[model samples]
Target chain A: MTDRISNKKNITLSIIAIIVMLAAIYVLDIVIKPTSSWSNLMTCLEKGTIYALVAVSMNLLNGFTGLFSLGQAGFMLIGAYAYAIFAIAPEDRATVYQYYEGGGLIHFSLPHMLQDMMGGADAFGGTIGYYLGIILLMIFAGLITAVIAFLIGIPVLRLKSDYLAIATLGFAEIIRSFFQWEGLGPVTNGSNVLRKFASYDSSIFPVLVAGICVAFIVLLINSSYGRAFKSIRDDEIAAEAMGVNLFKHKELSFVISSFFAGVGGALLAMFQNNINAAPFTSNMTYEILLIVVIGGIGSITGSIIGAYLFVCCSEWWLRGLDAGEFLGIEADFMSPGFRKVVFAVVIMCIVLFYSRGIMGTNEFSWSGLFNFFKTLPKRIAAVPGKIKAKFSNKKHKKHTENVKEAQ
Target chain B: MEFIAKWLPYILAGISVGGQFALIAIGYTMVYGILRLINFAHGDMFMIAGLVMVYMATVLPLWVSVILVLIITVVLGCTIERVAYRPLRSAPRMSIMISAIGVSYFLQNMALYITGGLTRTYPTIDWLQKNITIMGASTKMVTIITPVLTIVLVIALVFLIKRTKIGMAMRAVSRDFDTSALMGIDINRVIAVTFIIGSFLAAVGSILYFSNYTGIMPTSGSMPGLKAFVAAVFGGIGSIPGAVVGAFVIGICENIIKGLGLTTFSDAFTFVLLIVILMVKPTGLFGEKNIDKV
Candidate 1:
């Protein structure tokens, strides 16, 4: 009776936490007024939210299920194209006719309810309705990707982790190459589909969409099924012995992860108003993996935090490259590619020193919040001491200890 | 007869490329054989070696550039083992594999940053670029040289593994790491030598590859690396001669697909082949069928 009561309390607390997070996001969406310059920043945040969703979903497989997959981008591609085909306005499609001349012919007739929901098929018809349509399209995209993931996972997931990584990486490449083919352009719009979609002027829609998807996934993870997933991750053999269906759980997690990745892709496409095979390359997979690794594998909140830091750091680092101009070193010392170089260096340092990543499997909790406030005084008082500790003594000892432990 | 006549040139080209792949595949197989890690960064090492050769040729004479590239690649290979891999020698195989990927990404991105992501062209060495005709098919002198060199190196590698003291150490380490260490082998030195030999082979393959292709880019390693990895897996990852055979098969199959008017699908063909092979024989063509120990 006591255990049951505690379990109930735990569920209630988690629900309250999720509601609070959603409320905060909603407030932020309203507070951050759109300006011409700040619009890009807002969009970046929106895009970051989408990436956070994808990263979290990927963590389900990579972090929780212990399955190393590179097919996230492929799933995203599927979702982006599906959402585009389903949601683009008919008149807007005509304007983009030159690029997508055959698009109209390929789209099947929409269901009456969907047409009504989309405000009678006209461009910019009921604002709320169109918004709803976009959400539906994103979900549809996720479902389609989930189906594909299910089909692919059955045979491929049987392979061991390393081979699985190689196989999935190859699968992503194949998807990209397929999208690049001119013959498949009728449905895919090939490389030109990005230009055909309507851009969302407000960043709120994407943020809300991505946030909801992430929350749903988090809820799922905290459920009994989620414990099964964690069990598989901790030890597959043991999990199997304990009556957990290994193949079933793995497939479920894979499909769910791929589904969210697809939704994230659709949201990404909506934000950019255009996407190409170029951005969704193998590098994208690596970048997502970096986010997972840098944030803390198996932690959803960590994935979110890591995505924000990574995107912001990359932007700031890129901007700082030109800051050499202010210092009078006008020799073009830092090229644009210097950002990736710096990013790689940072990743190496993090992998070497802080292999558990920033959050180290810890989530945002009340106690953590209290600790942050408590430590603020000491952190501010001895900034130099803290910096020195991070670099010279503690970090080196930690890295060496990790290396020894690994060996 | 007509099909054979029309396909002969494509077949020859395929074989030439296959020979080049075979050279790189040996590196992957040997490393996997010794340590059950895939060495994801092998392709990037090849790219770096090509860059080194290009840089050296700019300053030094052709033969000297070639020799220096080989030496530098071997040293770099040994350094990678010592720094990135040696520490993770006792970690889970998956962790080492992940580190290998991290190292791979680090090398490629570092190259990207340094080289500005531009395609670097090799200086036209008069002899290397010379063309030759065989059975009415036009081919580069490098293509012919690649096969000959590949065969010689494979023979040499096989003999070294069979006869050398270090080779025995490598075999022992592969069979059981702690046991070999107990036998008083200088495990670190042997591992370094293994990496050096692997890197040396990769360097040779890179030179021939870039010479024939005429260009090198920061991202050039990814596709070749992936294909070579697949070849390693196809041949029973830890088997040396098996990797060679797998490389030739992949090269020839890819070429045949291109020759049959599916140039766009050639890259996909390799993965499709891997998936099919994996489904049919998970341990690979020549892999030892081991039961799950756990």
Candidate 2:
């Protein structure tokens, strides 16, 4: 009875916490427009949110289910294209597919069509339409990707680590080439850029979506099914022995992960406002995987943090580095790619030094924060004394050496 | 007769390309066989090998540049193995894989920075450029040379792997890392040797590969590299001869598909082939049966 009561309290606390966070974010979202200068930061944050969602999706498969799939980019590509096609306005198809002889087969937008069928045609052309369209498109994208994952998973998931990695990598390549195929030009526009989609006016939209998705993933991770996924990660044979249904759980995890990856990809298409097969290459998958590694693989909070850091590093912090200026200094030969060189070096260092990444499968919680605050004053007080002691010890090293020699 | 006439040149092109792929796939299989790590940087090494040829041929004779390319790539391969992979030997598989990927990105970006994203024309050799008619079909001389060279190298490699003491050590190491170490096999030396051999083969492959291709870019190695890795898996990962066979099959299949007026589907078709092969035989054509211990 007491345990049940505590569980009830925990649930109520979590609900209240989530509501407060959401409310605060909603107000903040209203406050910020897509203004200049700081708007770029907001853009970076928005991009980071989508990346975090993708990273969490990867973490669900790689970190939880022990499936090293490089197919995230492929699924993302599908999702982005699906969203681009489904959400593209009826009138814009001509211009979007200008170079191609035949425009896409999709003449009417899905949401608008649905709206007309519902007899709410007047309510369909405004921001509400955009919202409904994007949500529906993203859902369709997720379902499509999940279905693809299901089919691909049947054959590819049975392969072991590096083999699986190679297979998925091939899958991504196949997806790229398929989209680039000329025969599919009527529908896919044959590698031509697809543009003019409904996008977020403010960064808060993706922030809310990604935040809720990640929280949901975290809840899933903490559940019994998640434990089964973890068990599979620990050892597949043992998981099977324990009646975990290895293939079923792996497929489920793969489908779920691909669903979010697709959603994230849809968000990516919206953010870019132009969809092309060129951008959805293995490199994109590699970058997201790098984010997952930089974040603790099994930790959702780490993925969120890592996504922010990666976005900030590449978009904001590394910009000046790329411009040939280093901390108030300028160089003549500073090429555009110096920032990436430095960034790659830093990533290598992190991979070497903190292989477990920033989180190490640990999550950030209120209790942890409370404990940190409790120790804050003591740590602050000890810093000066510790520095002084270090200085003194270095200065008195000769006497200490003499003492050691005497001993 | 008309179908044969039309398809014969493509077949020749396929065999030629197939040869280079076999060489590259051999590198993948050998490294994977020993290290049990997917050396993602291997493709970049192949790219760098091509780049070295481009840079050197502009300044030196073709033969000297070819020799220098081989040397530079060998040194590079060894250095990468020692620096990027050696320390992570005992770390988790994922960490090593990430390190390999980091090395790959670093190399590609550095090339990008140096070349300024320019696509450098691969220096052509006079003799290798000759168009020769074989069985009423004309094809580039390099195309005919590629498969022959691949076979010769494979034979020599098989000899090195089977008839030599170092090859014995290599086999032992590949069989069991700890047991070989306990038996006094120098793990580091064996790994370095594997990398050297792999890099050497990739260098030669790059030379033959770029001969047929138009130009070299930072991204050039990625496509061929991806295809070669796929070939390695399709042949069965860790099996050398299997890699060679897989490469030829992929090369020929893609070429034939390209010939079918579905040129765009060729790349996608390779993966489709991979999926089909994997479904039919998950371990690949020659991959050893997996044995698990409780």
- Candidate 1 docking class: medium
DockQ values, each candidate: 0.60, 0.62
In order, the interface RMSDs are: 1.5, 1.2
Model 2 Cα lDDT, one tens digit per residue, A115-218 = 55555545534556657767888899989998998988888888878778988998888888888887888788888888886666666688878877888888
Residue B7 of model 2, lDDT score: 97
Error of 2 at A95 (Å): 1.4
lDDT of 1 by residue, B1-294 (tens): 767667877887777778778888888888887787889889999999988887888889999998999999998898888778887787767567767877888888888877777898976767867888777777778767777887788888888988998888888888777899999999888778888888988898888788878788888877888888888889998778888889889988998999978787899888988898899998888998867777
Task: Identify the CAPRI category of the predicted complex in candidate 2.
Answer: medium
* Highest DockQ model number: 2
Q: What residue runs in model 2 are displaced by over 4 Å at the alpha carbon?
A: A1-35, A99-102, A112-125, A376-407
Candidate 1, superposed: residue stretches over 4 Å from native: A1-40, A92-125, A191-193, A322-332, A375-407
